[model samples]
Target: MRRMPTRAKVEMAAYGASAAALAVVPSMEVLPAHAAAAAISGGSLWWLYRKAKTGDFARTIRSAQRLLGPVTGGVVYAAAAAAPGRPWWEIAVALGWGGVMAAWLPVTRSTWTPPAETGGPGYPPGFTGLVMRLWDDAEVAPGTWLEDIEQTVSPEHPDFTADVVALAGKPVPRLSDVDIAAAFGVPTACVTLADKPGHGPGRLRLTVAPTRRRGGGIEEVWAEVVARPGGAIPGSKIVHVKTFPAQGDLPARGMVLAEVEPGEVARINHEQLCSAFGVKAEELRLVAQSRGREALVTLYESAPLKGARRATRELLTLDAYGRYTIGTAHDGTDAKVHMQSAAGTFHGFLVGVTGSGKTVALALMCAAWALAGLANWVTSARPDAQMTAVGRHVDRQGAGAIFTWWMLKAAIALMDIRGRINGEVGHDFSGHSPYPGLVLVLDEFNSLVGDEALGDEIAQMTDVLAREGRKFGIGIVFAGQSLNLSKLGGEASLRDQVQGGIGVVLRIASASGGIAARQATGGLAGDVDIAEIPDRFNASMSLMDRMHGTVDDVPGETTQGVGHTVTGSEAVMMRTLYVHLPKDGSPDGLGEIFPEGGGINTLTEREIQELTELGLWHDWTMPPPSAGGDSGDAMPAFTGVEAGGGIGTLAPPPVAVKAKKATVKEQVLAVVDREMTAKEIRGLVDAAAGTVRNALSDLVTDGKLRQVDHGVYAPVHAPADV
Candidate 1:
């Protein structure tokens, strides 16, 4: 009395009709019953076999039924034919065959179908599934290679187990961040993530879409809960997914999903992303952005410092990025330097250990200023130190501190005088100033700031200068082996001010292996990591190519100047220019002052001509600073090139001397009777970039004169005020 399936009911009805036909029509008995039985059996077998092809159900039984149907029908015919009128035998065979069909009937069912594969990777089965994947050699798929195994493999191959690795331990078709996110029971777009400074993982609105099974076509997803990772991403909370159109280079337009909230992207950094994808450390770039924590990422084809650039006059203005570049970030864009503010209110702090290119940094910045028609006021406690190079191009030497109180007094006097001039003229000059701004390069800050006798005064001077020199168009740049807030001076702390200041900190280091890596990059310390640099002791191929298109253009170990600026909270590696300074002896004995193989090298004939044309190069043999070196006509640079060909070979240039008996400083001090200014004394002495200012300063230190006001100095005999 049970209701049968539709197919069963139809077949049953047909069977009854057929029975009725045979019984009702005696003449139909002439129509063979065996033939009718054979037709019915063939149709049933064909239909059942088609059902077997679609799903896993009674496969063996279907074939048996196909064979049995014909055999039983034939048997029925045989019994009827062999013994005519023994129709009971044929009836018994037919009933038995029908009973067997009922016992062997199978139901239709669908098997597991996996979802589509994603670019990141797919969710793989667990360890149990891995063990089950082994197959015999014959059953292995063609052209499929087992990873990490050099040869073809079969299931549970003995040799494979012994020799195979996980291909650098990265699992293929394994659960990835994308897969895990998708498995969160929602449709989500998985964003690839990595850790990086400046631009890295940050807040992003990701549309989370659950991933469907691989190879599953048009199948409904989210039918089951997604399997989450054994360990969740730290601090991440599940958010509802959002569907979007195809964006950027995402895999599909089908269901662009965002699975996380904004700011979630920020948490994913270069390291995390690399580990997740099993890629190398540098494959991704979190390039510095003009604004925002979300910087644009780009892949670089090659090293950013692959080439070198020289400092040129055209690169002198604010329109350009820096006084000179240190190098480039991993991303090939210029690591443009921002040394100080427009008002010269800030200072540049170059922090690096010895051999890390501190001197190179100094020269690069100074050279840029010198080339731009800006003044370079450099100083070193040591006269013969490498810091002397920048002063070579200037009319007067820019070095020599001597770790004495006199040194501090001279600096204070110099800055005080310049500060007053800036106050009078104001910082808003249209064209350039005779001294556009003072770039006071302190070579050994520790030496001066840590000096036993003058350390405190020097420190105080540093703070005073930093506090007040900016509006007066003067900026300070400190470089030394040892640096810290205590060495910087001032009662209140300036550590935060310097660290979180408006200046570029060129963080430098060069250790290929070990702990340097751990301490290599971080906030304010190393925002950018400088990869391998061209030899600082030699000219690089890029430099050569830039000059002559061949190594022969400018050969030898030309010093390299490389670093990274942690300005604006972002780090960018940079390669500063190889500045060209006059050779051996310029007016201030400034030429050839940097380390033999440092940021500033001796000017070649071609470079000398270029700077000479701009009137930036000095012809030392023509006159000394005490003479008319600052105001008189300069001889061609060629005339000053030493005959020995130390950067040049030429005869000495012409010169003129006043033949005055008094020393230059003597004349300057004599004129300070009624509070004479540097320029007034210079005119009285008839000298240029003359020794007057220093003479006045020295006389004050010697108690022979007093700094009455600003640049004016009064002799001991003068009035109290002037």
Candidate 2:
């Protein structure tokens, strides 16, 4: 026989395997007669399998069997094969066997298998459900242990202890003291159990009481459980449970007390109070409640009699309390000063190290007083007197005039007080009107008058103010790095004059003397050593009364005279005047007294003409007439004469003609420098191109620079110099 083809051999092998599979399947077992329908149904499945293996329709039939499975699928396959059937029963039997095989096929044998009896990796069945289901499971029984557990546990069960325990292993011990305690979410000492009242089997009563642990009381509850004899298992009943918070427990309270009374109390926590007042914490004493109350009361009630208005203004107006109307200006004109004082008198000394804002405080006080409609009279002997003479003069001329005469006089007098009077004495205006009543802010008072030479004068001034200023409404504010009563000649007298003292001790050389002593014992009567003053303008001022232990708003009365308060506006004006005053011609100096920025040499030709017309200039002359037969034999000659002079004196030369040349040059340069380019120089000069170029080149060559880049020329030198 010829060797069979590989395809034919494969087909024969497949058919033989199918036939063997069919034969083996039916012989295994058969459904009973009652299961005959099932058996027949299973036979149809075998037929379909044969169809799937033998025909092109095999994959579809197998897929249909897979989707429809077993019984229902066998019926469909049997019907399809029997449409032209040779034997329906045989087809039925074959289809039934196929259906049975399909139904029992292990499709997932490679990928998955049934878990072992011990179960899979996750929690055993009913673990969560077992916890929930155990109550229903017959082994544990419902309502059996619930009551017993409820006895030791809470009906409103705490989350941590709601657990199930199997009683099969051993006798169920009554919930442990720890477990019972945990069930109530408290400590073990808080829980206890008692046998049931009737001593029934497995019955108990539990009481959970609060425990005093960690110094805090705990709430507690009580419950009872009685076990009843049952058919399956002993059942439990919750008799009673009660919950209540611990009694006799009070909330914790702060230990601080309202020890100090409201009136005249000195707060011990003065640093805290000062903080509230927005001042340096170290500037005040820390007192206990009683002392703090006393101190606070003293401060609240204290007032300076002489500087009452000033004190009120500072405390009320400038302070955190008073809401006084702040006037924009004196009757709506230019704002002159910041009026802060209600009564208009101020008396205090400002003490701070150099650059510690002492000067600024004085200025602020003066301004406040001036705004209050009181004149501030600052008298400083220091060469830098700008801060002291703010509103003393109006314009530069007025400032110059005052500094030339009046300032000089005041300086000379001050020098005389220090025994340094060098020249002849000038006019004394001690008895003048508008006696500047506001504070006489004297800066660097120690330096103004040498210690030895002017001690007496300083003492005398202090005495005068101490003894008589209140009567005259004159206030004094002495400022310095160091202020000593001895420097003023007498401690008692000096202290008497300065009832209201402010000390801003940036760094104290010795706390025992000077402002330290006065500030320590003055109004505040405290040992406050200001190590440094802050940069804020009035930061140190608020501590004045506290450091001195003085009462707020209580002005100290001095026998001197009525104290004058300085307003903010006047202080600003004085500062402006001081700043504007030329250094050399300042009132405290003996420099040239010419008007500021308008000296003799700076006088314009027109000004000179005006002066000459007014007969003010000493040297002014005119040119002679041109010789044109009108004054035959006339000779140009000089004659020293004055204009508008008496008979025998020749009429003075015309100043206009004498100043004409300088005047014309000045006017030309003025116009050219303003808007002239190099190209436009000739038009403005009204001269030939060569002449204009020469003048322009000359101006540039002389160091009167111009904008070369823009081709615009301006005078590099001072206009007045030009």
Candidate 3:
């Protein structure tokens, strides 16, 4: 009774419990044996679990030696019990030999060994041997998983590693600790599961012990698992041993300190870290607090981003901080992305050519933000029917009937004043703005940039906003066709900062998309693979949606809007949510009132009435064609007409066969055979408001037309004589 040690007590319990189990297994007769066998197995598991909790072992051998005694000895004891007529001395000798072999094996020079085990928590029987023999380059075979498996573009990793480690009945292992399991006899366990969600299971790993060799390890062994007969590989983890510098760059904690030589810190920068680890830099996590002065870089591999969905209302919940999910990453992760969701107002530039669905994408993004309760404003310096539709649901839809440059100029001016007000209030301004989450959407940004005078003012506004307004919760959405960061109105600092700022940039397919990608993302456009996006949205809309409706008659494909999303230095493939264009036909009688259909209607009935009250209506009207009886039969107004003109009822000269009308683009390109004012082109083509300007810009951009001076455009292939 003199204070038996805890280790001795555990050993006694294990020996007594295992012996009882063998004694019952041979009795095989009936209920008593069954009860006894179950008790032995359950009791052994409970006892081992408690013993594991009792003490920690630095090496696997120490712990395995303990379990090795019980497990291997139990097998021998069972064999002896099963031998019907074996002599008592023979049985004793067999048990004693097994114990002696177990005790002496560790002292012999050998490799990581496995201990025989029945079963324990989290780990199955034979798990140690399985991991020891087959932990590397193993995959979960197809049939082992559920049959109704949701096969994705990528496979999934299993979550079985933690359980295996837990079942190993050892204390959790540290990075430097040889802690794979006490039974596997090795000190490491690493499992790389399926990157795709619903990942299947597999274990991959290799242990490397470094020696004096430079850039070469001393000894390396592959921990490959062999599948059971007719069984699939059970993947639980990937394992590898990391080598760290022995000195200061020496790894104290889990991280290996990359060399911090002069300028070497930056030279071994984020990309270098990713390259060293062989993964996307975004997958790596930098340790914030390292024990040593040297920084330790940590790489964390989570589920790869994937299974992007369409725009949903749930994704529209953004805080005043301007955080919003425009869409998900193509890699199938749970990460939500916000454009320029920083502390204050910054700029996000979106570039895509016409038919690239850029406008629709921008519109939907803005709508998502607005629905999220973020105070968003819009401005289109180059106002058009499409842009008008995009902004219809937002704050810039004619508050006080304001539109175009009025809104654009006012937004910029307000940002300046707000910046001033913010300085008076405080720089951070209590976490957000007075009107928090103010997103000024600059639609058709290149038009503003195209203006020699307004471009400078806009650039000046951008510099200030991108500088101070972001602190005041003022963010800007810069959208245009083929927007180039370097060509953003000669502001080098502005371009540099924005290109490197905290906003998501989307580069869709375009003529100048490559330029924007190179300038803004500093990456190749070829990587985007726009062609992969199928033309999936060709289905017809309702007749109403096609005619008087503002919805796109030819709806954009779900995949067509796919682009490259650039968040700082990293770029990932992304697909913007499909935009359901709103129906925004002009109100009935609106065209009649406008007459010219460009600016506000000069001949509105209200205006006409007011003019009549002021006696100006009479002046504007033509005196009702002179009600004085047309002054003697209207002075024979048709005198020059031939007598045959009177026979208009005679088939109207075969109805003067009409020709099919051509598109505004065709007309513009043909007429640009000679120099002409935009006004002349408008009169000739009679296009809609903003249509001529868009066409002109397109013609210029496409090398179809050259602007000789303001408003005058001549065909690029026009004859010199003309």
Candidate 4:
């Protein structure tokens, strides 16, 4: 026969010696014969049980053999202590026999020692060995271990299953560093750290599956995949699982849902979660919720409108409530602006630096208003550059635009009061036939408000229109580069009125501009950080790659018309649709929108008569082109009252008369509401520091200004509206 194994030999030796001790040790009588035999047997059996419980046995040891492990020596040594008659050599031999059996019988081997209550979960077929290996490798807890682990399968996803491990120490963060995907033979996306209710913070759960379980498709849904009605948002799931799609342009589209107390959600760090998930910090977003126990976390993808979106007539068409689609939001939904709600009308402000798509955004509004049967009058400081397309939709004007705007407001006010008095209408404009809504578009509006000679008059008129024109179906849309109230005629009330209606802040030119934009619309738009918005979608991406020395940078598409739109209490980052994209050979989208004599809205005789009575009426005609044919071509004009102080002109046919430029001293006085240095005044006004200082000195001597501190002067009188 083949040689017996070493373990078998050791077992034979241990059993033979123990059997001899039980049979012969009692006869030798360190104690009474019967008592000696019983003591030996009981002591030997206890040793065997201890070995088995601690995972020391070879697993092939029979209970009969295991019980005879020569522990008779230990029993006799104790009996000798009481007897005091036993030989020392005999006791020594008995003790040596007990030692040999203890060392030899429980073959030194490491067997799987699962927890006491629930041994362990049953791993998937062919995965038991790997799970055991990972358990030893992970060292989840040295002292406190997993208990009551159960194999669970998701009801919705047949291929998705997990081992719900119940443990005392939290293993969520540690498990993130572990190669869980390798242990379970699944794609990394399918492995998620999750929580279960009633488990307490001490325990964590994880879900995993085999790659084959997903049928070899990369975009497989995991056990945590939530079935939303339209995939618009990840609804709450009070289970321990992270929902992530396996494939996307980005690394992964994942959502983490946690059931937390009302205030605890604020403490959850999204950036830390992003780090754990191996995504950039900006990718994660904590969705705002009202009172709730669940906190939803998700990632924002790149904006969808990466290229020029052609303007279509259908998109320009306004709804019955005077809302029209301007572009797409970051969430891939349509972005709209409310020109007039059913309850009341609204004014709007659009702000961005040059080349930031300020004009493109304005063009969208103009086209929409034209389609909605509103009379839109377009005017601009830099009129010839980007105002051409918008001009094609309505009558264009320059210096006389403000005068015309005030006259139109008066006409609408007359019409509104007349209708209300006659019981022909309610308090609000009806947005119908003869008294159609009107929009006074003021492009580069900052230039008008910043003009020292006429800024106050324009601001006062604008404030009046903003306050009273809404009830009469009249609105104003101001477009500019900044939202500085001081630059906007220093009227905080005007800023408040424009913001109450609609506000769009595109890529800001300066940090201060961004702060002003964000602060101004904070109530309406929530917490959109316009200052952090990139100039282009790919701008940061390219910069980052170059900084890391891996980029051969290519030109990227602009974030033109990309900004936040605030209406009522909601705001969304959006990209405005292109109204005039020259690269696409559709330079003039307004032509397609109008398709007629500029779609101009002429004044009704009734309204024109009201203007005549107010001394604001001029002949509605275009004057003959001048001999030089360069500058004196009369633009379309309507009868309007002429205001004073270079604000308007007296003409049979209302002609464009340029506004007066302020002198250095007047400019200096206009800006010095607070203490400012000569250098600061020179920076604001296009004048030398010496000239600014001289003007400041003259004003201080005249009592119109005062020196508050060294090199600092403030206005002596409160700034008044001209």
Candidate 5:
């Protein structure tokens, strides 16, 4: 140690003298005065000590050492001034004066060490020692250093943040290069990294909110419970503790996600998981593993879906993003379905086993679409389908008419759109009114598509519409137990095309069905085992529980619409909006959805004309009144005299056909009794160019009239237009 300077020696002497005086002053006073002085001095010191412990003051060893002189002098003055009945303000003033002097005392300005000055291989002061050690071991950017560290104090589960700086010739450490929880000594799922907004680059915020372990052995207990006859794999550990929401004043429920060492996942069963988590077997759910390396251990306090959520009409309306809320997600968040996205309109596939709420979900979606101004045609295998609530809003229903209706409507729409695009009359179609969006609902799709007579053709037509219809504002919805390739005509790619919009997998009845759904959805439904969903929601009655009379009289609420909705790569658990449940004597759910007199979507007169002119229209489908006949084979009545040269000329009709009505084609030919150009004939007949041209071509093909000139047609018997 170096010799002390004279000035330092003098300061040390003054501090000693003041402390010694403070000790003697109390004893030197009279008994009553001494007692009063002692009380005043002791109370002040006690308050300071409490505040210091709570971190309200900078009270380190070094700081206390430096502050000793001022503290002793304040106590002495306060004690000496304390008469038996002295005013409280006198003691307050003395304490305040002492605090001012302490602040003015020469001491180191910093309470914590700066990172740069904390040289050598030692960890920075105030940092968690474990974090520094792991950071070094991980080699997270060798030449990078941490600084400006911030930590949450006294938090139930704490978070830490630091600014990263690079040394000469080294890059800053990035968050992706290191697993935050591994390096930070917390659960992987407990670690979250976010950018510190407005802090510029190289600033990372890490939140490590591990669920506070109970009995200080949440993991240790879990490990002991899961231990095998031999032992757990060396590296296996619980890597995640799921955080739960507060129920009333307590936590809702809890779970843990653990990484079972490779090859050990299969060895563990639901019993082990339940025992490990301290939950009953029925209350435990083994969520699907990831790459066979992890096991999700869940403990449910109640059914995930408590009860049926009615699909109110307001819930069917679209938001600005063209999305609508269908139900609540498993995490108690809103589950939304997008009608339109950046990619395009999404087609839907609703698949589930019987009693899985598939029909109710379909009804909900259809009603929503109708309210959103989309045209709907719903077909069901059952004649008494439970869709009466929305029955009025749909254009058609019934398996017999589905294929024909879809083909005609789709063909007409496609033709009209193509003509407009090719003719440059309009750009690509965007969904709205008049030509509102179109959806073909195939309810009980398996029964309808499995019919031997219609199956192959229906499959082929479905493929066509799936490929081409979306661009023209037409979408198809297939609802059934499975949308697997075999059910969809064994066309491997058809499911992908049709389900590009939304996929709902409700409670599946069998293991194979789950496998088929996994293949059909391409695992977009997350890795969920659909067969287990109903069991998770339904109340359980084990043999022992039943023998002991512990089972509820009424079992679980039906897990009807409880299923998964494919959002992206992950499938989210959700309950479909309950549109309606048919009753014996009550009215349909339609009154609960649509307004009293809300009409269904239909084509306008102009749209009708456009369809007819394309020759895509079928007689069995809607026909214009001008066609004047219901017969599919009705021909244009000829009003002409037969010419000798195989050319028939049409003058005006001498008499209208009284037996049957003439078609639009006959009216067009009648307008061309004399020589007339195609445009002139179109103007007189009040028809589109395409329609007039089609009529003229048919008449010419039928040998009713011959072209007299380049742009004009003449009656074959007329004398050269003289």
Candidate 6:
């Protein structure tokens, strides 16, 4: 025979004693009736005490009911045996005893008890059990009473029914998981509850205890009870279960994890995390650590550009986890952008300082994204046409045309030198399909976007992107020297919109603190220091791959390695010259001036002079013509003839001169050209007062001209030069 446990043995002994006391009660009831009745009552009292000790109230009630039936029958029989003389009194006494026995039996069976209705003091079924289990298992110590309770009554227990109604009569507090997690010493990984359903009755709460460490310190343990979907447990089953802190031990920095409802993960991945939060994989660590399991995840999947494998490799090598990548090369000669579906995507803050090679890197990435058909480039700068010659193959017709045309129009629109907006600025791009993946790359982004009015517009635009862009495949890339929460409209909005950021510190007095610094250094202080960055060194080469949860330190030298640098003037000249000249002089004007065909060259003297004379070249003038040779040789000269005069008129004058040398009045007559303005002719002719008056009168009389003003005059006939 096996030995029973101590508690079980005690219960058995109590049961045996209760049974023996009840057995003799009926037999003794007939002798000395009053004494017998007292004895029987005493025995019943003893049995009741024993039953209570055994904690078997249900069994005790059943035994009492069985004993009542026989006792009542015996009472009736006794009344008959003792009723020979005084029959009426005897009958009444016997009837009263029988009724008393009947009443007592029912009372014993029906009295209320705690154990049958509820699960004693420990467990309650339905809502009560669910709430209790949530509380009890919340932060159990390794060997504590609560741990034992957890083992006995859990959500998976045989009698476990998650009806929250048990907590209906109890007072419970309402709190978010995050708050509960904070109150407790545990990492956020353990909270698994959801918000309460609209009509649900119970509150969700979490409890945590610090985990004991080997060094005598303690880490936190966590637990929580959340409103689950569906009805109560045992009846309702959990469709999907997720555990957070995907990576168990948190790094020195921190960690973040998320759980998604069955089919809901995809939406969260695309819109909330990727487009709204702009979270790259690397950035997830910080978010996880800070926000914990309750943090919402919204991110999207992205790919590298097609045909840009080399450029992608180079970019990855430089900034391994950076959000940006170099796409298809313009000329198909250098690194061609290859779109890889595995590249992933993010939305977040971006930082690029001066001399950080950010411009080139950005251009390269934009080109790649555009080429891969993943993003449409919306910028106020033209795609450098020279890119076509750089060994990167490009399609002039496909999406490339959209990029080229839009960029060209933007460049023309922003030009300040022409003093007037050009017609090219109005060129229509509405014909092209509205780009679903539109990414506005604002270079020197702060200049236009930082203004109060423009900032508001940008903020609104960002809001739209954060809220609705994912649906339309629209995104934004903002690059600048500094990014602060205020500059981005607000900290919360910026945090939500920008999931990934790249910081390139090319020597600045100060940098945005916290996350900004981490962005530059890849979360490693030694890897970069924005304030101490060397003149030519860019500390922001580290790629904050928020999508991958990594930081790729791409040295400045490496990312900028294959790119060329041209001064502003040089670039301008190259563009202008190459478009007019050719290498072999077949006379595609764009090719000749730029033999290397980059379209940059110096203008010749003759061309300069011609342009100057036309009023087209204002910034420069023609060089002096060379000495000696015939300067006017290139012009056609005029040849002419003269008419013979006066010889025919001389004969009549000789004789007449001798006869009359008579005195003549000899009045000086001054002819004034009155039609012309006096101011105009004042410096051309001289006259005395009276003499000029007579000449004017004579000229007027002769109908030569007339005065238009007091001193003005008009010509009677057409002038020499009109």
Index of the highest-lDDT prediction: 5
Ranking of candidates on lDDT, top first: 5, 4, 3, 1, 2, 6
lDDT at 170 for candidate 6?
43
Ordering by TM-score: 4, 5, 1, 3, 2, 6
> Candidate 2, residue 95: CA error in Å?
42
Per-residue lDDT of model 2, residues 597-714, tens digit only: 3221222244335434433333112133222334455434222234333221222222212223443235447676554577776566666677666666676776655544466676
Q: Write the per-residue lDDT of candidate 3 for residues 525-597, one digit (tens) a residue.
A: 2122121122232233445655886666555334445555555444444556544543364432212111122
lDDT of 1 by residue, 1-722 (tens): 23345565554444444434333232234556656665666666676677677776666565554455354544444445556454544555555555554444434321223334324223235322232233212222222222222101111111111111123334222224444333233333322222222422222112222222331111112111111232112233322222222223221111111132355432223333223222233322212221122322222222234345654444433444334444444444455665454443446666555555566556666655554445555666566435554555542444333333332333344443444445667653223543455556666676666654445555666676665555545556666543544545452334333433233333235454112322432122323322323344233344446678553555544224545565534445555554543335444322333233333323235433544543335422222212125654643333232356321221221233344478767777666668667677777885556356666677789887778779877778777764
Error of 4 at 68 (Å): 73
Please give the clash total of every predicted structure, in order.
51, 91, 32, 4, 1, 85
Which has the higher TM-score value, candidate number 2 or candidate number 3? Answer: 3
Top candidate by TM-score = 4
Q: What's the true lDDT of residue 655 in model 6?
A: 14
| Local distance difference test scores for all models | 0.42, 0.35, 0.43, 0.54, 0.57, 0.32
| TM-score for predicted model 6 compared with the true structure | 0.24
User: Candidate 6: what lDDT?
Assistant: 0.32
* Residue pairs of candidate 4 with colliding backbone atoms: 195-240, 616-640, 616-641, 618-639
Better of 1 and 5 by TM-score: 5
lDDT of 1 at 222: 19
Model 4 lDDT per residue over 1-722, tens place: 23445556656566457545543454354557656556666767776777678764555265435454434444654454445444555545554665666555542321224334354544433333445446545554333333333222211232333344534454434465246665545577656556655665456555553433433211233113322222212343333434343233222223444454344322223233333333343221222221244544444333344555667778778766567888866545677777664346557878778778877787777777777777776666543545664565564444343444444444444544345433564345664544667777766666666654345545556665666676667677777775434533435555456665666877766454224555443232333333234565545453567689986566566777776777643446667877654534356556765534555765567765765675445532222112232455444333343443222232222223454589998888778767777778888987887887788888889898878778877777543321
Poorest stretch of ten by lDDT in candidate 4: 282-291
| Model 6 clash tally, residue pairs | 85
lDDT for each residue of candidate 6 in 1-722, tens digit (9 for 90 to 100): 23334544444443344333333333343557545545565666566667768878788776666455444444444445444544455545545554454334354433423333343246655434544554445533211111111211112222111212224444334435564344333455433333235534344312232222221110111111111232111111122222221122211211113333433321112112221222232222111101111322111121111111323323322233223333322122223222221212223223445543444454444444443344333342223333223213221211122232222222221121111112334421121323223344554444444433234434444444443333333345554554433444454544434433322232232444233444542232211212122232232333545556776556433222122111110100000000221123243321211122232222235433533443333321221112223545322211111122211111111111112232111221122323454444434446455444565556546766554546555555634333
**Ranking 1 against 2 by TM-score, winner:** 1
